[model samples]
Target chain A: MSWSFSIGSISGIRIRIHLTFALFFIWIGAAFWNEGGMAAMANGLAYILLLFLCVVLHEFGHILTARRFGSQTLDVVLLPIGGVARMKCIPEKPGQELAVALAGPGVNLVIAAVLFILLGSQTIMQDVAQPAKNVSLLSQLAVANIALAVFNLVPAFPMDGGRALRACLSYRMDRAAATKLATRIGHILAFGFGLFGFVSGYPLLMLVALFVFMGASAENNSTQLHQLARRLRVSDAMITQFSTLPVTSRIADAVALLIHSTQHDIPIVDGVGKPIGLLTRARLLRALHDLGADGQVADVMRTDVPTVSDRAELEDALRLMDEENFPAVMVADQRGHLIGMVTLENLDQMLLLARLQPRE
Target chain B: MSWSFSIGSISGIRIRIHLTFALFFIWIGAAFWNEGGMAAMANGLAYILLLFLCVVLHEFGHILTARRFGSQTLDVVLLPIGGVARMKCIPEKPGQELAVALAGPGVNLVIAAVLFILLGSQTIMQDVAQPAKNVSLLSQLAVANIALAVFNLVPAFPMDGGRALRACLSYRMDRAAATKLATRIGHILAFGFGLFGFVSGYPLLMLVALFVFMGASAENNSTQLHQLARRLRVSDAMITQFSTLPVTSRIADAVALLIHSTQHDIPIVDGVGKPIGLLTRARLLRALHDLGADGQVADVMRTDVPTVSDRAELEDALRLMDEENFPAVMVADQRGHLIGMVTLENLDQMLLLARLQPRE
Candidate 1:
């Protein structure tokens, strides 16, 4: 996502391309230029471009299916390996996920079938074993689409088949347990691929194996984190002993508090003991730079600081913090009095601890 | 980052490889085996592996420099195109960014120089023009490293040289302005590369041109967004008109409220008019699914719902919501009474409006 640039928006979704994907085009062009000159370069580029177009459509299948389940697709990025449709979040419901995963390969299957019908099945089959350079574009594309569908159907993590497998398994067990079992199977399959690649001296298969191995564990970890988040409460993670300031305090007071204590975000309370503002370290630093340390805390404190009740779900709390882009959230009691705070720094600590602690 | 798995941690930074990178090795292995057999395959693989090691070191150069500037390197992912060091954020200061950008190419220059010296200047120079297969490993690597350094130094968005150029430009102008100018120049350069690639029948260069062209505008858009965020406040964008429910209300009442009103988050207030909890549509739906409509709003409402001051910076509010991972943040007045709310849905609409509105 970092190195990606959007080429355009399609059907309300941004279509992005990673900088590296250019290398595939370049490499193929250079290879063809050296082998068969300008005409060959044109032919090769066109064929590959067509193939990439198919990849886009394949990704669109997944995107459309995901949209049906109410998931938003943020961007569709083309990498050298394949196109990745990044959704805001995947459907947690197994049936929805299963449909989304299958949709991609199904598109490819449809493309292959259509091409087969157009080009004649026997000719397409005969040309399937031939290299792209030696075969007709239609026949080559038909075979490539079939290969794409079959390759993606491999029961490996991060692949469509792996997700479908997990979805099916989830119907019979806990989501987390299903994920763990599916990931394990993915790893085993990856190991097989790696063994075969190494034995056959095919680095490509080994690379795929490595990808599968990594993807399986990564998905497992993410799902577990999500599960953990769902079970947590803001009260379980909020910091209760943090320092606070009255609205009448000067900026100098906040600077003094910073020196004497570890607190960076000091809540400002009203006469009624309600938190009226948050004096963040960044704001304090900027106020000091522009208005001097003698500036009133009231002038520097952010009045629109995000707050949460102690009983808020940790996931919801995290979601709020993420949405507001705030560094900390003040925790309030049922009386609407500030009781504690939740900061990203402390949330990370809580996550680390959660990882170490056993699941309930 | 979602699909990424850490192969290992080095110096507290995770090192990862994309699944497709293994394709490079596979390609080389197959190509070499077909050309010269096992010995050639071994030689080719070793050379390429060592080349990739140099790329890793190149990325480390950027990482170490960025770390010095207080930017955390989240992970280093190797793709077949090159290694990318994904930092939490680039340095805000121009000078620091310049140094970080140059550090990567500097590493490659050092590697090239060292290898050039080790292989002897004359021999290395002679072999530089030869194909990779015909040259000694050290000689080829020396040339390759030099090529890497030079290639990376070409001013292109998301590339090290382009960043350095922008950093230099930023010294004389606003960061957002500098980024826009730099991006425009990058697009021009990309156009040149594309034209040249087409003329020479080199699709690779065309691909690189496309990447550069897109990357420039993407970076420009992101920087502009950050700049816009710095200038706005939550009060400017929050939803002021929202319905509220008394804590004494039942879940059935909230359900009826939802059917008639567009508001999704129904804030629940206490007897004294202080906001106590939030009955989000999601929470209400889940409650209805499990507990039936007879549940009281007081029992179903999320007391930990995040709230924000009406006067906070929009960026800070966004950051808080993001960190808390909440969809919305309640806006409270100085009296600790909920007056408005900020939802991601509305925030996106505001962003779209901001994009269309001219800046001061």
Candidate 2:
């Protein structure tokens, strides 16, 4: 996801274009030029641009609908093959998710309909159906839009059709089970696509097959994790005992603590017993390398540590830790008093226990 | 990455094969069978299988070389495009990284060389140039190996050529900076490949172009994070303030806590001052729906939770959170005494600071 750069935000959701998409455009242009000179090259470039615009609009449709259900839209990234609308979180409610999933194909359908109406009004329907060797831009775009809509509705994972299938099945079963079923169907579709592609001499179909197969597997894995997280809590996984150091403690004292104790990080607390900063072995080493071990702990302690309420859901906590790339979180009371620390070692132990225990 | 199922550990790393690879086999079998009957199909299938075996050997070369330098291999997942050997961490030393990356291509080179030498005296050598159209299995495999070696040497991120480029530049610049430079070059190369692909009528070239562009961008982003993590500490980004509840509290008490406090989860502690479990709002609501508000909180609390040590590296901690899908990590001392909690909110604040602060 981080492999792309955001071009801008629409209605609070960012829009990004993968670098590969730019290459795809360039290829189309070059191929056109080589096949039929500058005029054809320009026409092909225009068509690709128009298609990508439609792709962007289709993603926005999903983003807007997700917003309607109170879920945040993170971004829409355009890949060489298609677009992906990254939601901050999928709607837990089956209906809401279904609506959001359908919105994307809805946009494509609307585009295709509009194009059809315009072509019909101009009496160019025949020309559009059997596109000429050198067709007009408007007609080409219309045909491409229709093609996009139909292709995306092929009931494959990483496509709108697969999401629609999952959402519909989720109405009857748990999300995990629904995803598993959808993934199985996706694999079947991938195999079918690959076979069709080879027989028809269409290489693009092979790419689609690859995408669907990988996408379905990824979806299943993530769904499994969500199910696992649902069965666990924060307390059962948090670390309770940790070393604490006073803000006034000397760097020498912190160094001594590191040498004698198992702890590699020491929380620095003020006189009121409130955590003010964190003193880690790495920071201490850096300080010693520059300012010497005689320096005060306050001079080297990091003050931007993240904290969490002792009473918060483990799922939310894990999400936060992942987003922020934090190693540990300090637990505190409502009065902002530092209570304890939670870390990865504790989380792993919790997971091991959960896996070993029988499901209730 | 999700294209395959891991088989087992090899020198502490998992090995997997993409589903599309099976499709590749089936297609080869069917194509040859249709062209010239069972014997021809068997020959084609054998050739394709032999080519993939070369690919596997190439990947193993990279894995074994990395292990020699004390680097850990996480898993090797075979993609339709190629195999990806995930390392626990890339070697920081320029020499080690260069050696590990070149190992894959080196293996291919050896195979190609050996094939050419053996076939040089055989009658098959006369038709090696057009082996794809010919029915000779050994000849086709020999040609394929040569192509694989040459194609993989093209400068592209996540490829041997790109990594080699980065390693060379890293000696003079920072690793992140080297990655940025290499990625930019990769983008240019991707464009070139795309253009040539279009003009040459080779559709597979388009896929190679897309892979290069995306891979380069991913490498850049990963390098940036690695650099940032090296400079930061776990404690500097942990959360410290939180809420808690007694283990004996009722579901009604949880409801009251939710209504009166902003906290959405409560860690339940026993009389011995140890955390017994956690009760999340979602779970509490589910319990209330199933067992009524009169139910005891102990019956609804999740006892399996994730935790972290206050001293763990920030990056490692974040990876654990992602792997376990935990919302928060409880920090504890070496003796398992409750200390504090870290959450996503606090980590975000630290990230904001990191972005706002000027790099040295």
Candidate 3:
């Protein structure tokens, strides 16, 4: 997402190109320039662009399927490695996941089929073995599409086939277990790919191996976190011993509370003891430097502290804290009087404790 | 962050490598394999690895400086394009930001200086111009570090120089205004890079251009949102009218309420009129199919419905709802009795209205 610019938007989904992707073209142009001059540069550019066009189509295959199942596509980013379609959420249903996973390679298969038909299958086969300079563009494209399909089907966390494999496995077990199984398989494949790349002096295979290995582990970690989150309530984790300050308190008082208490953020309450603002350590320090320690806490405190019901789910509270980039959330009772607080540090501690607890 | 594996950690900072970065070596190996076989491949690998070593040092430069200012570095990820140090938050002070920004290129400058002394500046330049097969690894790395320094110094968002530029500007102007000015300069530079790349048949420049363009716009968008958020309150944006369901209500009853009202989520209250849970339309529909319409609303309602105080800032409440992925946040008065709700739709409407409002 960083360093990527939207080239256009289609059906509400932005199509973005990463900055480094341009390097691919430059490298190709420079490589070809010495071998065959301007014509080769033009040819290389066209080929790479066409390849990315197919890649974009392949991502669309996944996007359209996800949209059909009610998951929104946030954006499709074209990286130097390949295109990635970021869905709002992956569908939980095995059937829906299977369909979405298969859709990408299916599009590639279709493209390959059409290219083979138009260019003739025999010519495509010859082109696959021959060097790029000698091959016809149509034949080269046919082979490239087939390669894309095969490459994507290599059972990895980020690969289409990896999701398809997980979907199948989930039908028999839990989603988390399925993800673990698929990730293991992906890692094994990645190791093999890396080994082969090293032995055969092929760097491309090695790069893919690294991506697969990381993707597998990352996916497993996320799934594990999701599993832990599935069984928590706000009451189980909220910090009940945090100190609160009155809205009338001075910045000096907040500074003292910050230094004397372990709390980095203190709630500022109104006359009826309802939280009106939050005096975060960062804000207090800033106020101390700029507005002086004599400034009123009400003037320096953040009034936009998102409050959550004490009875709410811990997972929801965690999500809120994470999303708002809030240091902490005020937990209130039904009448909205602050009863507790949920800080990121405490939430993390809760997660660690939960993981350590043996489950039935 | 999503697809990177930790190689190791140093002083609590995790060093990660994206799987795709392995491709850099593979690419170099293949390019040189034709020129000089295994020897060239070995030389290429050694050169690339050394270059990345320098990149790692460059990132550490930023990480160490940030740590000095008390900003935590989440991790440093090595991408095919370059290394990215994900800090918890950018320093608010102009001086701190400037130091953090300059530190990266400062590391490269030191590396380049040391390399020049060791390899000799004349030798480094000759090695850089020579083809891969003939270049010595040490000489190549010396020149590479110099190139890295120069390339990063190009003023652009996500680039160290751009941050330094922003820090300088913010000293004289407001942060938001300074960011706007820096981003404009970044965009202009990006446009120039893109045009030059297209004319010179260099794809690498184009990619850098794309990154700069997007980073500038993204930074601008975030600043605008932060500004808008600073001006609103929860009560100013909350929905006052909403349907509620008693805990005794059945799924069928909830379905009826959902169909009759615009509310997609209804608060389920206890006998004493305190909210006990939320019956979301999606949950109700899922329950209807699985548990039958006769199921009690309490059986399917989410107990973890995040709540916010009516007096909280609208931006904070909006952030909480967005983070929790809650359709609506239950708004309660000081006694914690539900008085209203804050839906994302209403939050957006409020933001839009706020933007259109005339400044004081």
- DockQ per candidate: 0.02, 0.06, 0.02
lDDT of each: 0.79, 0.71, 0.77
Judged by lDDT relative to the true structure, which candidate is superior, 2 or 3?
3
Name the docking class for model 3. incorrect
DockQ for candidate 2: 0.06
lDDT of 2: 0.71
What value does DockQ give for candidate 1? Answer: 0.02
Best by lDDT, which number?
A: 1
Off by more than 4 A, model 3:
A194-207, A240-306, A318-330, A340-349, B1-360
Better of 1 and 2 by TM-score: 2
Instruction: Show model 2 residue runs off by greater than 4 Å.
Output: A1-3, A9-13, A88-90, A121-125, A128-133, A183-233, A241-306, A315-329, A334-356, B1-27, B42-360
Q: Write the per-residue lDDT of candidate 2 for residues A69-111, one digit (tens) a residue.
A: 8877667888888998877777868888778877877898788
Q: Give me candidate 2's TM-score against the actual structure.
A: 0.54
CAPRI rating of model 1: incorrect
Best by DockQ: 2
Cα shift from native, residue B266, model 2 (Å): 29
All candidates: TM-score of chain A? 0.76, 0.73, 0.79
Candidate 3's residue-wise lDDT over A1-360, tens digit each? Answer: 269888998888899998877766687788789779999989988898899999999999999999899987878998777898977667889999999999998998899899888878887887878876899877777778888998898777668889999999999999988988899999998999876765565555666788789978877766665676668667766766567888889876775554333356789998887888898866876776667757898888888878889778877776666555678888889998988887766554444333433341
